[model samples]
Target: MTADPVVETLDALELVDHHCHGAVTADLDRPGFESLITEGAAWPGVSPFDSPVGLAVRRHCAPVLDLPRHAPADVYLARRAELGWAEVNRRFLTAAGTGVFCVDTGYAPDRVTTPSELAGAAGAAAYEVVRLESVAEAVAAGGVEADAYAEAFRTAAWEAVRRPGVVGVKSVAAYRTGFDLDPARPRAEEVTDAARRWLARGGRLDDPVLVRHLLWTAVDLGRPLQLHTGFGDSDIRMHRADPTHLTDWLHLTAGTVPVLLLHCWPYQRQAAYLAAVFERVYLDVGLTLHHVGPARAGAVLAEALEITPFRKLLHSSDAYGVAEFHHLGALAFRHGLAGLLRERLDADELALEDALRIARWTGRENALRVYGLPDGSPDDG
Candidate 1:
């Protein structure tokens, strides 16, 4: 009963998955649905979301197909139970040589209810849950609600950070599809007004309005903040997906508060640039790893590593279903790393120290630092 060497090596490294959306909802099951359809359909061996080739065919033929969405709390509990997060943590403790950091994500409306429940369920002493909330109310209040939301965020963030296992705040500012673009839309003006009010209240541009407020709040209270970056869902215009779009926020912050950029998709170059330019702008190369597989991921990672400081790079699965997909993502990430090492770095020249550093630093250390955890290795309880 020997373990696969690759699996064993990955296990021994104890990698930290910095960015992942562990919320359980049918919405997160989009990939699973695609897999099921592809598995059962006439066109066998065809992945609906397959890379460049499949993407081309899909663009030309099936462009804009609707996918299933999952419900929130129930989906989260179901997936966690199915994935055996508790068991996963135990196994992680056994395998992780250094340690692994798992940051649980919760959007605003959802966070108002889920965090307490999830904390009870996970039961691990050091698990972190980052909360997400809408800027809608804040926007309507004409900066009043925005200021209140900031205070609310601060209260929630500090509570979570101080909780037995909770670590930091995960806040999002923009909606790729939900918000109204025109003044005609109800409350649209409110949202925009709130943004203006928050800005007038000293909010910076490069920072997501909600996140900028949260970052300032978090930093003042001594907590870490994770912000969404790069391309989001299919509904979002690709142009808006660019992390470069946040240049104003970046310039405004100037590394004052540590920010973890989630995804960093097609805009890896821009992400890399931010990572290089701002000491606090850390990039999580996870969602892209899930959307684009190993080969492309290898190229992206190689390019990012070559240009960006290794300390700012983070690894994550960003997988939400049964732990199966999460494990798959981790394996895929390792394979991508191996490929990058062999193709870009000289063979046998990839030192274990560097590998360990990438695996540990990107995975957990940065997260631990951002979240302001006790200055010691993570302990699995």
Candidate 2:
């Protein structure tokens, strides 16, 4: 088969991973690595290696560690161990061909690389996307009074977004309260009552009223707002996590700031619908592509772009804990998107120039424009 120019172009284009967490700085044993790859519990009777994402790591990332493609899980792990975490992270992160990383710096159970450290490993530039829930939780943990919670949280969140290198804000409301909550901004009394109850109970910020406040606050911050939608870990109720549930909320916030829907998996079509209709709404199948692997990436990407404007689609890895995801996510995206555009090009559905333009927009340009990041020269990683 002849090589597709679309594939070649995308393979060389450096992606801008719009939403991802930092890679772990510590060396991971098989168990530690396995836990990070799968969303479900790593049951004793089963191994994550049998899953699509695990197999993807071996097939796509093994060679980055100097092992052959489709290397056995144990062999792959051994090779990764031999390389050490720093070297392993460098190899995969560089090999991904990602020029920029907008890393989410919250949710660190293990010691992970900072944005600068992660960017350094990949020879890329990095920016920060503050998590709204983390900011609110910190205000609570800092001992703010119930009556004063609303003002205190607003001030803290504003300060967080104003920090140097902070380009945007994110909310894991899907994981916490889900998107089915009342769309309107919570009233002041309602916020105080919710904060008082939350401060007393004290844990993750899951109160619906408080979550609504976080979402509204993200809009008021005036930077790009990223929302976790569709599939997630075991804690999420998938039905409530759908992006369409935010229709009312999106309507209310139109023209305020860019609303980025991240990791829309089974709901990619639904996300596509919103991106098509809403001027400021954008969507990326970031976590979904890596989980589905390169073999099925084109199919998922196809659904996401079915009605989505080419400019509204962006790339992401949602990679966390392990460095293998950084490489695998880019590989899947390059292969998946290349294949889709190649088919269209062969059918005369689009011009070669147009296909190339879409390739650039989706892989890198779209993210840079959306986040207001400089289009720096591509890193030759």
Candidate 3:
């Protein structure tokens, strides 16, 4: 007997990971690797398998390394250690079923792959997403005076987007100061005063005016702007990261640029609501997918899909620290999305053709249209 047609089709989808970070190129011990899988910024000091994302690695990722299904934690880690980082990267990355990667290279600079290196390992086309903070820090370090901070940052940002591989820009305002900051653009005096304080002290760009100004600059450039929202590591203030806090800014920036919201978890529905009402806003449930694993991904993705327009949802792994996330993230998404869509098809809620079309749109077409990539071949699987 044949298997379910809906799931079979989803298995063949070649997704464009609209947002992600490069994998670590260095070798890892069990704890080092374990630290990567969990959502926290620091190592948990205990075994990672006690968590959802950890247990998921044991159940789903063990086999990709030639270990048996649900291999014991110690055994899986041992096998991973024996394989070394190179083989591990190639195996997991090749298994991810992704054709294009819009890579954000600003995370863990010393330990991670470059966008070029990432593309070579995954056998996919890779593009860059410049982090606003990285560019700002560079300008500050160049000894540009605070009075020139605004102009210097603007010039640096302008030059960054003009680079060969850059396709978009991202802000971690959710990580720094959250989305609760005043939505109005700060006046030039406010920017200069804030810049002076930040530079004279520790040279860190923590000023709210500067943050707001950076976001507004991205809007002016009119490229896709990625904002980290909702759940993250310990660094994020959970309550302050809610995307609903972005309502005022989204309203003001409407029609000026495309804003991509990343990693919406407890706020997935809220993000979906925003995407539904705002023409320029879109959302993704990445990092969350792999953490929830295939079994629980449906509930989360269903929440995101409930109000999100089909064209406004895109795919991402948000994978970092390890390539296993790159593999497992896509696996969990395929399993979850296929299962949910199949149930609807069977219950007569959706037509066969329409179901497949939505699957294609969320998996790739949406990202290509949003990020302006030329359409890739269908067999990218």
Query: What is each predicted model's overall lDDT from 0 to 1?
Result: 0.50, 0.91, 0.87
Query: TM-score for each prediction?
Result: 0.62, 0.97, 0.96
Predicted structure 2, TM vs. truth? 0.97
Please give the distance, in angstroms, between residue 269's alpha carbon in candidate 3 and its true position after superposition: 0.6
Ranking by lDDT: 2, 3, 1
Worst 10 residues of 1 by lDDT: 59-68
Against the hidden true structure, what lDDT does model 2 obtain?
Answer: 0.91
Highest-scoring model, lDDT: 2
| Candidate 3 lDDT over residue span 18-41, tens digit each | 899988887888767777877764
User: If both were scored by lDDT, which would come out higher, candidate 1 or candidate 2?
Assistant: 2
Root-mean-square deviation of candidate 2: 2.9
Q: What is candidate 1's lDDT per residue for 1-381, written digit by digit as tens? A: 954443345455555565554433333344443542221232455555454423322322121111122223234334434544444433322222324445564532222113333333333223555554433333333444543544454455565567676665565543332211221212434434555555565533333334334444555654456666565654455566566666665666664667677776777788888788876777777766645554466776776677777677777766543333344456556766766654433467667556655655655565656555565344211
lDDT of 2 by residue, 263-321 (tens): 99999999999999999999999999999999999999999999999999999999999
Please give the range of 10 consecutive residues that has the lowest summed lDDT in model 3: 372-381
Candidate 3 CA-lDDT value:
0.87
